[model samples]
Target: MGTRRPNALQWVWYTFGGKLPAHLSEWVLHDVTCRTWVLRHFLRALTQLAPFCVVVLLLPGPLHIRLSSIVLGLLVGLFYSASAMVETNEHRLIKHGYPPGIGRETRAIYRDLRRTARDEARRRRGWE
Candidate 1:
């Protein structure tokens, strides 16, 4: 029997929050880390900001106000994209061959290693 392919709606749902099927999980994770994923999110943020920019440009207002509105809209869109979409991004990272808490553990290890090296250097210099 042929394997069934996911449909468009399924893809959207999975991208948002739906459970990824076992067979496609690896492929999805790889796709999420690829350059295409970054481009897709960048375009998504731009698309979200585009309408606001157009509206602000069309509004009857002083140039400074319109420019400020455009800037505000861009900031809001970026904040929304980063905050609201973090869950899905984290989920993808976790699935992409990274263990849960790997980021935290790695950071802690690096911090400790750097501290130890710094202390050793200071001791050698008679500063500790």
Candidate 2:
């Protein structure tokens, strides 16, 4: 993790596809590849979906209809967002000057680390 990070405004800007300053590249890398990357990606998707959700709410319709539309829209939006989570993170990394596929590689390395740690713990407990 990097000591330097973007402020709230800069974070929102970055979440919406704006690039942060070069100095924050390390933070950006961590943001997209850390253990909480999935939650981070979903938060970004929600931030991007919020406006459209409000618009759906405002559109003239029956109460249930408008609310249902918002729900369905969000479900669809999140579906697509989840589908592209890896690519999206990779793109963010690229924008921060990381080579392509770093996100995937980083996540894989973390997964292996977790698996190794789990196996070690299991062995010590005589459960493996």
Candidate 3:
């Protein structure tokens, strides 16, 4: 199936840690890598927070309150973007042709490789 762009509500759900259905996950992963996924979320958060930042600065408020609002907006934006990490990783895995739940297997394989390399190094040092 062609990838359907997520609507606002779906985006909100995804931002809040909702899992995409498998079919959609594959389609989304086809379009986005880990870097683009992160940039997309960051841009989205900035887009949402920009207006709030402007309003906070423009509104008639004490200096401290305005500063606090700006800070709070930044914190909230970062939190919202970071909350999508799970979905981002899922998409990244699919993009790389790995099925869901392969992370542990991949890590184990990586660890084995590292161990073998280390053992080979030790053996070579012993010979020398």
Q: Number of the top candidate by TM-score? A: 2
Error of 3 at 67 (Å): 4.6
Tens-place lDDT per residue, model 1, 52-101, is 79988999979999999899889887877877554555555576445665
lDDT of 3: 0.65
TM-score of 2: 0.91
Off by over 4 Å in 1: 1-31, 88-128
Q: Which candidate has the highest lDDT of all?
A: 2
Q: After aligning candidate 1 to the native by TM-score, how far in Å is the CA of 112 from where it should be?
A: 22
lDDT of 2 by residue, 60-115 (tens): 87989999888999999999999998888899999989999988898899989999
Better of 1 and 2 by TM-score: 2
Question: lDDT per prediction?
Answer: 0.64, 0.92, 0.65
- Judge candidate 1 at residue 62 and give its lDDT: 97
- TM-score, prediction 1: 0.43
Question: Native-vs-model 1 lDDT?
Answer: 0.64
| Candidates, ranked, lDDT | 2, 3, 1
- Identify the runs in model 3 with alpha carbons over 4 angstroms from their true place: 31-35, 44-64, 72-128
TM-score for all models, in order of appearance: 0.43, 0.91, 0.41
